[model samples]
Target: MVTPSTQEKARLGGRADVGAASVAGAEYSTIEHALSDALAAHGITGLAIRADGGIHRFDSADKPKGNRNGWYVCPTLEVAVYGFWHTGEQHTITTGGKADPAAAAETRLAYQRAREQREAERRAQQARTAEQARRWWAAAGAADPNHPYLTKKRLAPYGLRQRDTMLLVPLFHDGELVNLERIYPHGAKKALFGGRAKGVASLVGSLASADRVLVAEGWATAAALHEAMGVPVVVARNADNLEPVARRLRQRLPDDVTITIAADDDRFTEGNPGATKARLAALAIGAKVLMPTFCPGCARCTDFADVALCRKERVA
Candidate 1:
């Protein structure tokens, strides 16, 4: 039976044999002691890196808290960030101001070791998950006319592959397949775990010499707009990622190409993160915002896809 102390150690990267209780304080002496504490186990689980070049931690991989990365250490910014998803505790430490060269070097080395371990873990996990996505993508037939998500959304699958009953959308970054988002028949969705997500997005139509492009939070929503407008849609996967993915897209495309931020109006949510973030992203790149219009008393509809489905139903 796992004791409370043991469980806590596991969550803290499972090196309790050399953890805070054992190595910290009067029990150990010398510079080695300080180095040990600074370079805690940090574990292989719950480890991920953002596209913005930050190392991150999650509470648990099995039951992940999807708000933001739990803890992150940014080497470039010379900062370390810590936050708990449940209690909302956050802290940041800037290591750049250290005056002692030896101490600073020690600190850098400690963090470097920890970062290397976590990065190795990330690469391995991504390789395994990417392979799985590839096999699923390979076996999937073209989107069927009667696939539930397609039929319900009134959208066609443009190169969207499926495995079994789940719709698979390949997420890529810099022309490499890094992750995937699987959509259920009822519209429930999830992605393969332990892969880089920030700035990673799915594309529907080819951007080859296109003058206009659209970006949105979800694949279904992108598909809806692509069908209606005949423009390429980039799926940023989530609202929080709009800015990162949009910034990258802006940098990649020509200055003349019009990039529209198609936002989801989360009317039911307080602060409406979707629309707010989309606008901010658009503003950052001097792009335009395209929001969905809802019908009278349409409290249930939050996105262009929802509005389109509602209209299609009304017409039928």
Candidate 2:
């Protein structure tokens, strides 16, 4: 009796084991089989290829997560099964079908043209969005103290405006309004789609005469912290923008000015993005970090504002 090694089986592209069963260690003979096995191992069962070089997760396709495939790979339009699932790691094996050089050249040219067109369209759209944001800023009145989100958060609107039941928060980049985030009565929040989102922030207080400043995520948190700490809090809006906003602030602010990253303590979520990003932003600038102090036996609170409000309620 003869037995094939795992690497040998992979090279042969012949399935040593096939089924819905555990073939994680088992090797496959063909590129299709190996690719299929890789995806199946990651829980992508159906593997439906869509019309736009996209691989669906199951028999019926839904919106791809991360706004990108992020899961499967497609080397060519004709040879999709040649691709393998990348696990955000350095892929070692290179068994996928080779794309035709000439065909790839044409695709590159087409992609360039499409990218340019999209860029032009995006610029135009941003201009339109900026104009709309300016108009809304002018037309809307000051945010009401009785607004649902404001009341629930127990924070007054710094410079926000009311549009019907939604509170409009203007987001700026380089002193120019680029986008707006609307807070609904139900606490749902959304930024204007297609508008520039990165590195933009909504200010809660004046930066004038400020030697040390606090930076945080979310408008309510920043507002609450500014009230409690008596320092200007720059709302970085989200975790991903922390680094960019911090770098920009470092460049723009004075050498003597201190920037403290008041990161949200995202204890519920995996990876603790809020605190991790805060530390990264502070580390990049050689600044300080002010984490939220959750009270003893606190279970749900994950931010400075939440903790502050809890303390206030307890006092009352």
The lDDT leader among the candidates is 1
- For model 1, the local distance difference test gives 0.69
Whole-model Cα lDDT per candidate?
0.69, 0.67
Give the runs in model 2 whose Cα sits over 4 Å from its true position: 1-99
Candidate 1 versus truth, CA RMSD in Å, comes to 9.6
The residue-by-residue lDDT of candidate 1 on 1-316, one tens digit each, is 0011111111222122111223212332322222223334432242333323355555533344563334444443343333334443333233322223343343354345444756687789888988877777778887676789899888888768878898889998887888889889998999998777888999989999899999999998998898889999999999999999999999999999999999999979999999999999999899999999999887799999998899999999
lDDT of 2 by residue, 1-316 (tens): 0121222112212122111112444443443544454555444455543424433323212335533322333333322222122222111121222323343343333333433444676689788888888888889999999998888888888888998988999999998998899999988988886788789988888899999888899988998998887889888899889888989999999999889999999999999999999999999999989998887889989998898788888888
- Quick one: how many clashes does candidate 2 have? 3
Worst 10 residues of 2 by lDDT: 12-21
Error of 2 at 79 (Å): 12
